[model samples]
Target: MRQSPNDLTPGGQQRRAAIIDAAAQLFNEHGYHQTSTAMIAERVGCAKATVYHYFRQKPEILFEIHDQWIEELSAHVADTSDDVPLSEFLRQVFRDILQLMETKSDHVRVFFEYYRELPDELRAVATSKRDHYERVIESRIRTGVDTGALRPQHPRIAAFALFGMCNWSYQWYRPGHELSDREIADELFEIYFAGVRAESPASP
Candidate 1:
């Protein structure tokens, strides 16, 4: 019988985790289509069959990457409520996403770059998760509008704009001595919530 991720022994579990980590790096460096199980095994210091023992195929690994991102992000925002000010809520989102992207940079890179390559069924599952996340953001934005904590705009579009701004960090974000994720998130939120141009007298 194939061992489920949770059913692995202690050592087996370690190898499985290592395989995912190595696969993420390899997938990020080489596009998903270009990466092979052999490459992942080599990176993990194991035989190619070991990867299959854990994941049925490369696409399963890709789907797992997407699953990890969505689940963690979902859990992070599960406590959100209108009781919190919109600014605080949005700032938290910015902070969380930036933290995840910074720490799991390789995973972020692979998720953005390879999710589309998943099989149709896996892709559907991923899309459902993505949509659910967007809906939560939209719902929060609507509440913010009703409570006058945020400006009026199409909530769905606003959610897309926010994610688009943050998700692209995978392309060029580099952690260094220059700035911290919080600082970057601060700048990003300031730009997102506050317009660049001066507000006109009649704006309100």
Candidate 2:
């Protein structure tokens, strides 16, 4: 009988997390198609059947990685208070992403690079979650514009630009480098904010 992942005991949950982390690292290092269930099982120091016991198939594992990555990113903006200044709010959001990237670099890579590898149904779910996250950023940008905190611009395009800046950082960002994640985050926010902030009225 197949055991449900939801019914996992605490130890079982830890084992499952290990499997996912191992798979994320392997998938990040090797392309999704190149990686196999056996490889994942070996990385987890368990039998392939044990891997299957946790996840019915590789795509389920892939989807789990995608879910974890997106869920963490979503959490940064979830239930954000409007009272928070727009600049500080967005700055903190980017800061959080950089910090997460530092800690979960492997998962972050799989998220941006291997999303299409998910099966159609899983891909759709991931796409929906990803799109929702983008909308949250867009909503915040629109609010900034409406509130005169940001310049009048297409919120959707601006949102994409913001994502482009932070999302691509995983490609080059590394911890224990010249700049810490927070410093990099602040620099990115300043650069992004410079472009989007409401322009001052011309000298009268």
Best by lDDT: 2
The whole-model lDDT of each prediction reads: 0.80, 0.87
Error of 1 at 81 (Å): 4.9
Candidate 2 backbone collisions, by pair? none
Top TM-score model:
2
What tens-digit string does per-residue lDDT give for candidate 2 at 98-166? 998888889888878888878899999999999999998899888888777788899999999988999
For residues 1-204, what per-residue lDDT tens digits would candidate 1 score against the true structure? 246767878999888879888888888888888899999999999999888888878888888887888888888788776577667778788888888888888888888877778889999999999898878887887766655556666777888888988988767777764888889988898898784112331222
Candidate 2 global TM-score: 0.93
The Cα RMSD in angstroms, rounded to one decimal, for candidate 1 relative to the true structure is 3.4
